[model samples]
Target: MTDKLPGLHMRIPPQPITERSTPRPVQRPENAGAAFQEILKSKLETSTLKFSGHAQARLRLRNIQLDAEQLDKLEEAVDKAAAKGSRDTLVVMDGNAFVVSVRNRTVITVVDRASAKENVFTQIDSAVLTD
Candidate 1:
Protein backbone atom coordinates (compact mmCIF):
# COMPACT_ATOMS: atom_id res chain seq x y z
CA MET A 1 0.00 0.00 0.00
CA THR A 2 1.16 3.52 -0.83
CA ASP A 3 -0.17 6.88 0.18
CA LYS A 4 -0.78 8.95 -2.96
CA LEU A 5 -2.44 12.00 -1.41
CA PRO A 6 -3.54 13.37 1.95
CA GLY A 7 -6.51 10.96 2.32
CA LEU A 8 -5.95 8.53 -0.56
CA HIS A 9 -4.14 5.19 -0.74
CA MET A 10 -3.51 2.66 -3.50
CA ARG A 11 -3.03 -1.12 -3.36
CA ILE A 12 -1.71 -3.33 -6.20
CA PRO A 13 -3.41 -6.67 -6.99
CA PRO A 14 -1.44 -9.79 -8.06
CA GLN A 15 -3.39 -10.76 -11.24
CA PRO A 16 -2.17 -10.14 -14.84
CA ILE A 17 -4.40 -9.78 -17.95
CA THR A 18 -2.60 -12.51 -19.95
CA GLU A 19 -3.36 -15.14 -17.29
CA ARG A 20 -7.11 -15.03 -17.95
CA SER A 21 -7.97 -17.62 -20.67
CA THR A 22 -11.30 -19.32 -20.10
CA PRO A 23 -14.63 -17.78 -21.11
CA ARG A 24 -17.97 -18.18 -19.41
CA PRO A 25 -20.59 -20.31 -21.14
CA VAL A 26 -23.89 -18.67 -21.98
CA GLN A 27 -27.28 -20.25 -21.18
CA ARG A 28 -30.35 -19.81 -23.33
CA PRO A 29 -33.85 -21.28 -23.55
CA GLU A 30 -34.05 -24.16 -26.05
CA ASN A 31 -36.47 -23.21 -28.81
CA ALA A 32 -37.03 -26.46 -30.67
CA GLY A 33 -39.44 -25.02 -33.23
CA ALA A 34 -37.13 -22.18 -34.05
CA ALA A 35 -34.24 -24.55 -34.14
CA PHE A 36 -36.14 -26.88 -36.47
CA GLN A 37 -37.09 -23.99 -38.70
CA GLU A 38 -33.51 -22.85 -38.86
CA ILE A 39 -32.43 -26.38 -39.63
CA LEU A 40 -34.93 -26.70 -42.46
CA LYS A 41 -33.94 -23.36 -43.87
CA SER A 42 -30.32 -24.37 -43.82
CA LYS A 43 -31.14 -27.76 -45.30
CA LEU A 44 -33.02 -26.06 -48.10
CA GLU A 45 -30.08 -23.82 -48.86
CA THR A 46 -27.46 -26.52 -48.47
CA SER A 47 -27.84 -30.18 -49.19
CA THR A 48 -26.53 -31.35 -45.85
CA LEU A 49 -27.62 -33.68 -43.06
CA LYS A 50 -29.76 -35.76 -45.34
CA PHE A 51 -30.80 -39.10 -43.88
CA SER A 52 -33.78 -41.45 -44.03
CA GLY A 53 -35.82 -42.70 -41.12
CA HIS A 54 -37.77 -45.90 -40.47
CA ALA A 55 -41.56 -45.83 -40.78
CA GLN A 56 -43.70 -45.64 -37.70
CA ALA A 57 -47.28 -46.88 -37.98
CA ARG A 58 -48.81 -44.07 -35.98
CA LEU A 59 -47.04 -41.33 -37.87
CA ARG A 60 -47.87 -42.94 -41.20
CA LEU A 61 -51.50 -43.23 -40.23
CA ARG A 62 -51.57 -39.65 -39.00
CA ASN A 63 -50.12 -38.42 -42.29
CA ILE A 64 -52.84 -40.20 -44.19
CA GLN A 65 -55.53 -38.74 -41.96
CA LEU A 66 -54.06 -35.26 -41.47
CA ASP A 67 -55.34 -33.47 -44.60
CA ALA A 68 -56.93 -36.37 -46.45
CA GLU A 69 -60.26 -34.63 -46.81
CA GLN A 70 -60.82 -30.92 -46.25
CA LEU A 71 -64.56 -30.43 -46.21
CA ASP A 72 -64.86 -26.62 -46.12
CA LYS A 73 -62.51 -23.86 -45.00
CA LEU A 74 -59.46 -26.08 -44.99
CA GLU A 75 -58.21 -27.04 -48.44
CA GLU A 76 -56.10 -30.12 -49.00
CA ALA A 77 -53.13 -29.07 -51.11
CA VAL A 78 -52.60 -32.38 -52.89
CA ASP A 79 -56.26 -33.22 -53.21
CA LYS A 80 -57.14 -29.76 -54.46
CA ALA A 81 -54.35 -29.79 -57.02
CA ALA A 82 -55.37 -33.20 -58.28
CA ALA A 83 -59.04 -32.18 -58.58
CA LYS A 84 -58.19 -28.91 -60.36
CA GLY A 85 -56.85 -30.37 -63.61
CA SER A 86 -53.26 -30.63 -62.42
CA ARG A 87 -50.98 -33.18 -64.06
CA ASP A 88 -47.32 -32.26 -63.40
CA THR A 89 -48.46 -29.58 -60.93
CA LEU A 90 -49.82 -32.25 -58.62
CA VAL A 91 -46.93 -33.45 -56.48
CA VAL A 92 -47.18 -36.71 -54.56
CA MET A 93 -44.71 -37.26 -51.79
CA ASP A 94 -44.31 -40.07 -49.25
CA GLY A 95 -41.62 -39.94 -46.62
CA ASN A 96 -41.08 -41.10 -43.09
CA ALA A 97 -41.19 -38.26 -40.58
CA PHE A 98 -40.63 -37.57 -36.93
CA VAL A 99 -43.15 -35.43 -35.12
CA VAL A 100 -41.82 -33.42 -32.23
CA SER A 101 -43.48 -30.90 -29.95
CA VAL A 102 -41.94 -28.74 -27.30
CA ARG A 103 -43.82 -27.20 -24.39
CA ASN A 104 -42.62 -23.85 -23.06
CA ARG A 105 -43.16 -20.19 -23.64
CA THR A 106 -39.40 -20.41 -23.88
CA VAL A 107 -38.77 -23.85 -25.30
CA ILE A 108 -36.39 -26.14 -23.40
CA THR A 109 -36.98 -29.59 -24.84
CA VAL A 110 -38.50 -31.37 -27.81
CA VAL A 111 -40.91 -34.23 -27.30
CA ASP A 112 -40.34 -36.63 -30.16
CA ARG A 113 -43.05 -38.94 -31.47
CA ALA A 114 -40.52 -40.99 -33.40
CA SER A 115 -37.84 -42.27 -31.05
CA ALA A 116 -35.23 -43.37 -33.58
CA LYS A 117 -33.73 -42.33 -36.94
CA GLU A 118 -35.15 -45.23 -38.90
CA ASN A 119 -38.60 -44.64 -37.48
CA VAL A 120 -38.58 -41.06 -38.71
CA PHE A 121 -37.87 -41.97 -42.34
CA THR A 122 -40.26 -44.87 -42.28
CA GLN A 123 -43.15 -42.85 -40.93
CA ILE A 124 -42.61 -39.96 -43.33
CA ASP A 125 -42.06 -42.22 -46.37
CA SER A 126 -45.09 -44.28 -45.54
CA ALA A 127 -47.19 -41.14 -45.42
CA VAL A 128 -48.77 -40.83 -48.86
CA LEU A 129 -49.00 -37.25 -50.09
CA THR A 130 -51.50 -37.84 -52.92
CA ASP A 131 -51.91 -41.47 -53.89
Candidate 2:
Protein backbone atom coordinates (compact mmCIF):
# COMPACT_ATOMS: atom_id res chain seq x y z
CA MET A 1 0.00 0.00 0.00
CA THR A 2 1.30 3.56 -0.90
CA ASP A 3 1.63 6.10 1.91
CA LYS A 4 -0.68 9.07 1.54
CA LEU A 5 0.71 12.61 1.43
CA PRO A 6 -1.49 15.71 1.11
CA GLY A 7 0.74 17.94 -1.07
CA LEU A 8 3.28 15.63 -2.59
CA HIS A 9 3.76 15.21 -6.36
CA MET A 10 5.62 12.57 -8.26
CA ARG A 11 7.70 15.26 -9.97
CA ILE A 12 8.99 18.55 -8.64
CA PRO A 13 9.84 21.69 -10.61
CA PRO A 14 13.50 22.66 -10.80
CA GLN A 15 14.66 25.72 -8.99
CA PRO A 16 16.76 28.26 -10.86
CA ILE A 17 20.43 28.27 -10.00
CA THR A 18 21.72 31.64 -8.89
CA GLU A 19 25.15 31.02 -10.40
CA ARG A 20 23.77 30.19 -13.83
CA SER A 21 21.74 33.39 -14.03
CA THR A 22 24.80 35.36 -15.05
CA PRO A 23 25.16 35.94 -18.79
CA ARG A 24 28.14 34.19 -20.36
CA PRO A 25 27.98 34.11 -24.10
CA VAL A 26 30.23 31.63 -25.85
CA GLN A 27 33.06 33.65 -27.40
CA ARG A 28 36.30 32.63 -29.04
CA PRO A 29 39.20 33.94 -26.99
CA GLU A 30 41.22 34.75 -30.11
CA ASN A 31 38.46 36.72 -31.79
CA ALA A 32 37.67 39.07 -28.91
CA GLY A 33 40.61 41.45 -29.39
CA ALA A 34 40.23 41.57 -33.13
CA ALA A 35 36.50 42.25 -32.92
CA PHE A 36 37.06 45.05 -30.43
CA GLN A 37 39.81 46.69 -32.52
CA GLU A 38 37.76 46.52 -35.68
CA ILE A 39 34.81 48.10 -33.94
CA LEU A 40 36.97 50.93 -32.58
CA LYS A 41 38.48 51.65 -35.98
CA SER A 42 35.11 51.82 -37.71
CA LYS A 43 33.71 54.22 -35.12
CA LEU A 44 36.65 56.60 -35.46
CA GLU A 45 36.43 56.66 -39.22
CA THR A 46 32.66 57.19 -39.59
CA SER A 47 31.99 59.69 -36.85
CA THR A 48 32.11 63.29 -38.06
CA LEU A 49 35.01 65.42 -36.89
CA LYS A 50 34.08 67.99 -34.27
CA PHE A 51 36.17 70.77 -35.87
CA SER A 52 38.71 71.18 -38.70
CA GLY A 53 37.82 67.71 -39.92
CA HIS A 54 39.67 66.24 -36.97
CA ALA A 55 38.54 64.41 -33.84
CA GLN A 56 40.10 65.61 -30.63
CA ALA A 57 38.26 63.31 -28.25
CA ARG A 58 39.14 59.81 -27.23
CA LEU A 59 37.54 57.75 -24.46
CA ARG A 60 39.58 55.62 -22.15
CA LEU A 61 38.50 52.99 -19.63
CA ARG A 62 40.13 53.10 -16.25
CA ASN A 63 41.89 49.98 -14.98
CA ILE A 64 39.92 48.73 -11.97
CA GLN A 65 39.58 45.18 -10.71
CA LEU A 66 36.05 43.76 -10.69
CA ASP A 67 34.37 41.12 -8.53
CA ALA A 68 31.94 38.40 -9.58
CA GLU A 69 28.84 40.60 -9.50
CA GLN A 70 30.41 43.42 -11.48
CA LEU A 71 31.82 40.97 -13.96
CA ASP A 72 28.34 39.59 -14.53
CA LYS A 73 27.10 43.08 -15.38
CA LEU A 74 29.94 43.54 -17.83
CA GLU A 75 29.12 40.26 -19.48
CA GLU A 76 25.53 41.34 -19.86
CA ALA A 77 26.48 44.68 -21.38
CA VAL A 78 28.95 43.12 -23.81
CA ASP A 79 26.43 40.48 -24.81
CA LYS A 80 23.82 43.12 -25.59
CA ALA A 81 26.22 45.31 -27.54
CA ALA A 82 27.54 42.40 -29.60
CA ALA A 83 24.05 41.17 -30.37
CA LYS A 84 22.94 44.63 -31.54
CA GLY A 85 25.52 44.63 -34.35
CA SER A 86 26.85 47.89 -33.03
CA ARG A 87 30.19 48.80 -34.58
CA ASP A 88 30.65 51.43 -31.91
CA THR A 89 29.60 50.04 -28.56
CA LEU A 90 29.89 51.59 -25.14
CA VAL A 91 29.61 49.48 -22.01
CA VAL A 92 28.57 51.53 -19.02
CA MET A 93 28.76 50.08 -15.53
CA ASP A 94 26.55 52.55 -13.74
CA GLY A 95 25.67 51.27 -10.27
CA ASN A 96 23.76 47.99 -10.69
CA ALA A 97 22.45 48.68 -14.15
CA PHE A 98 24.77 48.27 -17.15
CA VAL A 99 24.62 50.49 -20.22
CA VAL A 100 26.06 49.48 -23.59
CA SER A 101 27.30 51.43 -26.60
CA VAL A 102 26.06 49.83 -29.80
CA ARG A 103 29.51 48.97 -31.23
CA ASN A 104 32.03 51.47 -29.93
CA ARG A 105 34.95 50.38 -27.81
CA THR A 106 35.53 53.34 -25.55
CA VAL A 107 34.43 54.72 -22.23
CA ILE A 108 33.03 58.05 -23.40
CA THR A 109 31.12 60.75 -21.50
CA VAL A 110 31.62 60.35 -17.81
CA VAL A 111 29.74 62.81 -15.56
CA ASP A 112 31.32 61.64 -12.28
CA ARG A 113 27.96 61.66 -10.58
CA ALA A 114 28.09 61.24 -6.83
CA SER A 115 25.52 58.48 -7.02
CA ALA A 116 27.62 56.65 -9.61
CA LYS A 117 30.08 55.68 -6.92
CA GLU A 118 28.17 52.58 -6.00
CA ASN A 119 31.14 50.38 -6.83
CA VAL A 120 34.71 50.67 -8.09
CA PHE A 121 35.23 48.58 -11.22
CA THR A 122 37.80 48.04 -13.94
CA GLN A 123 35.95 49.23 -17.03
CA ILE A 124 36.68 47.05 -20.04
CA ASP A 125 35.37 47.11 -23.59
CA SER A 126 34.90 43.88 -25.56
CA ALA A 127 38.61 43.82 -26.23
CA VAL A 128 39.14 42.95 -22.59
CA LEU A 129 35.93 41.03 -22.12
CA THR A 130 36.97 37.87 -23.95
CA ASP A 131 40.33 37.74 -22.34
Candidate 3:
Protein backbone atom coordinates (compact mmCIF):
# COMPACT_ATOMS: atom_id res chain seq x y z
CA MET A 1 0.00 0.00 0.00
CA THR A 2 1.15 3.62 -1.00
CA ASP A 3 0.48 6.79 1.05
CA LYS A 4 -0.70 9.95 -0.82
CA LEU A 5 0.67 13.48 0.14
CA PRO A 6 -0.59 17.07 -0.65
CA GLY A 7 0.93 18.93 -3.73
CA LEU A 8 3.91 21.27 -2.92
CA HIS A 9 5.32 23.93 -5.38
CA MET A 10 9.17 24.07 -5.37
CA ARG A 11 10.25 25.86 -8.63
CA ILE A 12 9.77 29.67 -9.01
CA PRO A 13 10.45 31.96 -12.05
CA PRO A 14 13.48 34.37 -11.81
CA GLN A 15 12.73 38.14 -11.79
CA PRO A 16 14.83 40.79 -13.63
CA ILE A 17 16.56 43.58 -11.63
CA THR A 18 16.62 47.30 -12.64
CA GLU A 19 19.96 49.12 -13.02
CA ARG A 20 20.87 52.74 -12.24
CA SER A 21 21.62 55.21 -15.12
CA THR A 22 25.08 56.66 -15.74
CA PRO A 23 25.84 60.06 -14.24
CA ARG A 24 26.48 63.12 -16.46
CA PRO A 25 29.62 65.24 -16.32
CA VAL A 26 29.52 68.45 -14.30
CA GLN A 27 29.49 71.77 -16.21
CA ARG A 28 31.46 74.90 -15.24
CA PRO A 29 30.49 78.54 -15.75
CA GLU A 30 31.56 80.24 -19.00
CA ASN A 31 33.91 82.68 -17.21
CA ALA A 32 35.33 80.13 -14.78
CA GLY A 33 38.75 79.90 -16.45
CA ALA A 34 39.18 83.68 -16.55
CA ALA A 35 38.15 84.00 -12.91
CA PHE A 36 40.59 81.28 -11.86
CA GLN A 37 43.45 82.94 -13.74
CA GLU A 38 42.71 86.25 -12.04
CA ILE A 39 42.70 84.63 -8.60
CA LEU A 40 46.07 82.92 -9.34
CA LYS A 41 47.63 86.22 -10.45
CA SER A 42 46.44 88.01 -7.32
CA LYS A 43 47.77 85.26 -5.06
CA LEU A 44 51.14 85.26 -6.82
CA GLU A 45 51.37 89.05 -6.49
CA THR A 46 50.84 88.83 -2.73
CA SER A 47 53.07 85.83 -2.03
CA THR A 48 56.56 86.27 -0.64
CA LEU A 49 59.63 84.58 -2.12
CA LYS A 50 61.12 81.44 -0.55
CA PHE A 51 64.23 79.26 -0.39
CA SER A 52 64.12 75.66 -1.62
CA GLY A 53 65.06 72.77 0.69
CA HIS A 54 68.18 72.00 -1.34
CA ALA A 55 69.31 75.61 -1.06
CA GLN A 56 68.88 75.57 2.71
CA ALA A 57 70.86 72.36 2.98
CA ARG A 58 73.65 73.80 0.85
CA LEU A 59 73.76 76.91 2.99
CA ARG A 60 74.03 74.81 6.16
CA LEU A 61 76.67 72.51 4.69
CA ARG A 62 78.80 75.43 3.56
CA ASN A 63 78.32 77.30 6.84
CA ILE A 64 77.21 80.36 4.89
CA GLN A 65 75.54 83.21 6.74
CA LEU A 66 73.40 86.01 5.39
CA ASP A 67 73.02 89.25 7.31
CA ALA A 68 69.96 91.46 7.05
CA GLU A 69 71.61 93.59 4.40
CA GLN A 70 72.51 90.59 2.34
CA LEU A 71 68.98 89.26 2.59
CA ASP A 72 67.62 92.52 1.24
CA LYS A 73 70.06 92.40 -1.63
CA LEU A 74 69.04 88.87 -2.51
CA GLU A 75 65.38 89.87 -2.61
CA GLU A 76 66.19 92.73 -4.92
CA ALA A 77 68.17 90.47 -7.21
CA VAL A 78 65.24 88.05 -7.52
CA ASP A 79 62.92 90.89 -8.40
CA LYS A 80 65.31 92.03 -11.09
CA ALA A 81 65.47 88.55 -12.59
CA ALA A 82 61.68 88.31 -12.59
CA ALA A 83 61.41 91.63 -14.35
CA LYS A 84 63.54 90.23 -17.18
CA GLY A 85 61.33 87.12 -17.47
CA SER A 86 64.16 84.89 -16.36
CA ARG A 87 63.21 81.42 -15.24
CA ASP A 88 66.62 80.43 -13.89
CA THR A 89 69.07 83.05 -12.64
CA LEU A 90 72.37 83.27 -10.83
CA VAL A 91 72.54 85.89 -8.08
CA VAL A 92 75.99 87.01 -6.93
CA MET A 93 76.40 88.97 -3.72
CA ASP A 94 79.37 89.45 -1.41
CA GLY A 95 81.33 86.54 -2.95
CA ASN A 96 78.30 84.23 -2.64
CA ALA A 97 76.32 82.87 -5.59
CA PHE A 98 72.68 81.78 -5.52
CA VAL A 99 70.69 79.96 -8.19
CA VAL A 100 67.14 81.30 -8.21
CA SER A 101 63.98 80.25 -10.03
CA VAL A 102 62.19 83.48 -10.82
CA ARG A 103 58.70 82.21 -11.71
CA ASN A 104 58.55 80.03 -8.59
CA ARG A 105 60.43 82.63 -6.54
CA THR A 106 62.72 80.10 -4.95
CA VAL A 107 66.44 79.95 -4.34
CA ILE A 108 67.41 76.58 -5.82
CA THR A 109 71.10 76.40 -4.83
CA VAL A 110 73.96 78.19 -3.12
CA VAL A 111 77.61 78.50 -4.08
CA ASP A 112 79.92 79.75 -1.36
CA ARG A 113 82.89 81.97 -2.15
CA ALA A 114 85.32 79.11 -2.44
CA SER A 115 83.08 76.97 -4.66
CA ALA A 116 81.98 79.95 -6.75
CA LYS A 117 85.59 80.75 -7.54
CA GLU A 118 86.30 77.46 -9.36
CA ASN A 119 82.86 76.37 -10.57
CA VAL A 120 81.52 77.31 -13.99
CA PHE A 121 77.83 78.11 -13.65
CA THR A 122 75.45 76.78 -16.34
CA GLN A 123 71.76 76.11 -17.08
CA ILE A 124 70.97 79.71 -16.08
CA ASP A 125 69.60 82.37 -18.43
CA SER A 126 70.65 85.50 -16.54
CA ALA A 127 72.92 86.76 -13.76
CA VAL A 128 72.35 89.44 -11.12
CA LEU A 129 75.26 91.05 -9.29
CA THR A 130 73.83 92.35 -6.02
CA ASP A 131 75.30 95.20 -4.05
**Candidate whose TM-score is highest:** 3
Per-residue lDDT tens digits for candidate 3, residues 7-62, read 85466899899998999989999999999978976775666668899999999999
lDDT string for model 2 (32-120, tens) is 99999889766654543121111112122332345677655555555556655654443446422232343443333332235346644
Error of 3 at 94 (Å): 1.0
Best-to-worst lDDT order: 3, 2, 1
lDDT of 2 at 30: 88
What stretches of model 2 exceed 4 Å from their correct place?
Answer: 1-64, 95-131
Model 1 weakest 10-residue run by lDDT: 100-109
TM-scores vs. true structure, each candidate: 0.16, 0.27, 0.64
> What digit string (tens of lDDT, one per residue) describes model 1 on residues 1-131?
95468765666889756766699887766897799978965543332211123323443444433343321111233223333433222123333222211110111111233433343232111221432
Stretches of candidate 3 off by over 4 Å are 1-46
User: lDDT value for candidate 1?
Assistant: 0.32
What lDDT score belongs to each candidate, Candidate 1 first?
Answer: 0.32, 0.45, 0.86
Candidate 1's displacement at residue 32, Å, is 9.3
Show pairs that collide, candidate 2.
Answer: 64-122, 86-102, 86-103, 87-103, 88-103, 88-104, 89-101, 89-103, 89-104, 90-101
Give the deviation of candidate 1 from the true structure as CA RMSD. 17.1
Looking at model 3, report the run of 10 residues with the lowest lDDT sum.
2-11
